[model samples]
Target: MLQLEGLTRRFGANTAVDGVSLSVPAGQMVGVIGRSGAGKSTLLRMVNRLTEPSSGRVIHDGTEVTALRGQELRDWRTDCAMIFQQFNLVQRLDVLTNVLVGRLNHRRGFGATLGTLFKRFSAAERAMALSALARFDLAEQALQRADTLSGGQQQRVAIARALMQQPKLILADEPIASLDPRNAQVVMEALRDVNRRDGITVLCNLHHLETARHYCDRIVAMQKGRVMFDGTPAALTAARIRDIYGVSEDEFDTAPEMTAPALTPAREAALPA
Candidate 1:
């Protein structure tokens, strides 16, 4: 289990994530939804320690996450893989080599690390990377430069890299914000596949309510850095959504609807079990 006790972060006088606390169990797919500047990204960053918390504690499976340092912190980050809005891949590198980079933390001593830097990995590791790529239907593109693939393809490559870490949890911050509707559906399905098949817990920050409703097991809504609602997708009523977005009921009714396409059998089969 992952527990956040009064987690807070402040910059100058403005608090980004305010005294928020939550307990997430393993194998749950959670969607964190909120408007822009609602502190959703900051909350995930604090959990990953990419951004330090000003106060409170982050405990994961009995380990004090907020107090870890050096290798311990690095290991924590490895176990909790982060997928960003920008994909964060080495554009110049081949997809396979970029995926192999996830093993950098597992590389022990100077020689191993140096070998990884030069793109030298064990045969078993190479096979593992290939398997991850195949999981996302990117194995054939493994030798292509990352920049050459489409946005959705690059994001899948990023997911493949995360899988190479064998992460227990995934923190996805606006992962599909930049993709088109079709690609967004594909990416979200990939995330759901990992959560279901591999039993990896997912905490994804989503902008679209319908997408979250369709994909997540539970929904946590934030407003101005505070969690305003926490419940199953069906329990997130229209009134609650309006309240979280601070919009009038009429405005909410007229808002453009964004929904992911239904997954077909062929596409579902394409994603590895």
Candidate 2:
């Protein structure tokens, strides 16, 4: 659903993403893993047009998403929602309303009016919003203010908001960085469920390797603003990772793979199921 060709981004003399090209198909989840300043985040940001590319094109569906601005850019971003490391929700707003903000671009006139203020949502929209919260088992807390919810719950709410958009692609940048192991698992599992059932394309940038290995259909490794490796989890051996990170085995304790979004599904022939 998304394609990046020869994508490059530079800040002064330092290139953050260097000529990286990759494809994320519809319903696929791909993980981006790299060390600090390795350009993983830069690559993801460029895909959504949040960071303008110095060169190259980001193609979504068929349109060239790069170099688009104003209404064109806004419309492109609407179809491809971005979830961040920070929840970025309005702390004082109710969880339900926070998610309703996803519809801001699509909703019009009267229906938009009902949600902009303290106005109550319609039966259908409310149900859909509540269903999103329940996907992360936070429906009970929908009426509660966002500040009262835990960090994990808040991130889940953010994901629900993205889901409410019915986006074609989801970009998550270190989404689990702020959570504990248990909570991180919760959020990641929620993402997996969304990708599986809804067929939404996902590209997540993560620091951990083991985590990516487990969750991603394909792993794209970056180093010094360029793609160093792109392959299956099995192909990313210890030696390969060392080459990408330039770190020795003794540099860290745990060797957890940064399993993020989609693990590739095995191809099946279209015969009889």
Candidate 3:
């Protein structure tokens, strides 16, 4: 279980994330959806210690996350994996080797050095890498350098790398923002598959309303450093959206075209299954 109690973060006098408290049960898939500067990213980063909170505690499996440091901190980080809108992989490294970097925490310095982010892997590790890649249909590109793959392919490779870590919790910040509609579904399907089949907890940041409504078990909407709404997709109505994003239905309808369709479960499964 992941729990946050009175979580708050501030920069100077402005609190980017206010007194937020929520608990995500194991295996739950939660979506953080809000407009720019709504503090969604700040809240998500607090989970994996990427952004230290100014106050409050984050508890994961009974351990206080922020209190960990040194080797203990290193160990805690291994339990969670983070994905980003920009695929943060070593550009010169081959896809397979890049995935193996996820195992760095498990291996000691020298043993971990055996396979740098660009080198080949051991027979056993190679098989493990292949399995992760196969799930995202990037096994054929295992030997290809990260820079050579398409944007969608790179994102899959990033997901494969995260899978290789065998994380208990996956935190993604605007993961699909950089993808096309088709590729976005592909990546989202892979995430939903792991969340459903393996029961790994998933927490993602989404800009599109339909995307959050379709894939998330719950949606958290924030505005001006506060959680404005927390409920099912059905509850994120026009009024709630306006409260958080300051955009009413009239404003949305009158503005330039910005309609995006919900990604159905069938479409999520339309990936390389």
Candidate 4:
């Protein structure tokens, strides 16, 4: 299990994540939802050790993640992969090489690490990278430069790279926030597939209410750096949403749907499944 015990982060006088505690069982897909400045991004970053917590502990299956050092810390990061809002691909590199970067942690010694900079990977590793790309339906683009693909395709490439890590947990921060409606659905479905098929635990920070309700097994609502609600999607009713967002009933009614609309049949058929 993944446990966050009183995890808190402060910048000078501002406490970004305020003593947030959560216990996530294995294989659970959880959606962390909240408005801007609610600390959603910081929470995930802290778990991945991208940002250090002010005071608290991050424990995963009895290992005190916060206390890990050097190689241990690097290993923890490898075990817990992170997918960012912007597709963080090496724009100049080919798609296959970018995906192979995930295997860097598995390579021992400085020599092996240096070899990757020149795109020298074993045939078996190259095959594995190809397989991951195929899973995301980007096999044809394997030789293409990452910057040549569309936003949706680039994001899919990013997901394939994360798969190469063979991570136990995935922390996705606003993964689909920049995509168009159809692309957003495709990305969300891809994430759901990973959670179900590989049994990888997913902690995704989402901005859309309906998207979270649709893809997540459970939803965690945060307000002012603290969890205000934690339950299944059905339990996150209209009233609860209103309370979380601090909107009046009429305003809630007038607000736009919190997720991308359904894709048209033609558009759906054109995208990879």
Query: For each candidate, what TM-score against the reference?
Result: 0.91, 0.88, 0.88, 0.91
Best by lDDT: 1
- Local lDDT at 241 for model 4: 80
Model 1 shows how many backbone clashes? 0
Global lDDT of model 4: 0.88
Which digits, one per residue and each the tens of the lDDT, describe model 1 over residues 205-267? 987888999999999988778999999999987877776676753454345333223234365
lDDT of 3 by residue, 95-114 (tens): 88889888778776775666
lDDT of 2 by residue, 1-273 (tens): 788999987665567678888887799888888766677777888888767788899998889998678877877788899999989999998999999888776766665766667646667778899999987899899999999998999999999999888799999998998899889889888998989989899998887777888888888887777888899988988887777666753342244433233212131111111
Writing each residue's lDDT as its tens digit, candidate 4 over 118-162 gives 889999999999998898889999999999998888888888889
Candidate 4: regions farther than 4 A off: 248-273
Which residue pairs in model 4 clash with each other?
none
Decide which is better by lDDT, 1 or 3. 1
- Deviating ranges (above 4 Å) for candidate 1: 248-273
